[model samples]
Target: MAHLLFRLRHVTEEEAAEVRALLDEQGFDVYETQAGFFRLGVDAIWLADTRQREAAEAALDTYQQARLARERDAFEQARARGEAPTLWKRFLAHPVQVALTLVAVVVIALLTLLPFLGLATP
Candidate 1:
């Protein structure tokens, strides 16, 4: 009997492509289709003859687990910040912060060459 193995709905095209790549890597004849407002299909329909369901499941489980960990860390950081966020805001908050940071970094390199140029304070 032909059985439905797995079904997945992707929120975006890039996610769908990544799912397809994983399925392909596991040697499954992967295929997909677009549903309304999303992509839904047999992203990794397993063949009975191939019998690789375990490996495919492991790969997907690992992928989702890593994604969850990343999202959780990001959520914790956002909660700590409270609000008024965005990396750009944090970066641009202090006037001359960007220029001063670059200047300080350049000073380290200048110090390395100063002895040769006789510019070292004696």
Candidate 2:
């Protein structure tokens, strides 16, 4: 029986390529499924041999941990350098759009809650 190894939803192309390369390098018999027409199918990696599932899972876990650490470090570096966006920065960059979005959000929230609030008041 084939074992699902990884899900591909929201995965970046670089990440997918790295995963494929890692699986191939580890000599695991694997196959991939595409999210076919209308995105109905599962997009995932499957192991052909169930016996190799444990090893493949371990490899993937290790890779994910390292990637997570690397990403966190990069984010921290960017933040330290003031390259990461802050609320003030975003508002400065697009004040009008941000104000309009905030207004729309408040309007939608009020519209959604007004009926419930009215019932509770009585």
| Per-residue alpha-carbon lDDT of candidate 1 for residues 30-120, written as tens digits (9 for 90 to 100) | 4443344453434434435435666666777887788779878898888798754566676678648867787998998889888888954
Model 2 spans > 4 angstroms off: 94-97, 120-122
For candidate 2, the per-residue lDDT at 99 reads 98
Best candidate according to TM-score: 2
Q: State the C-alpha lDDT per candidate.
A: 0.63, 0.96
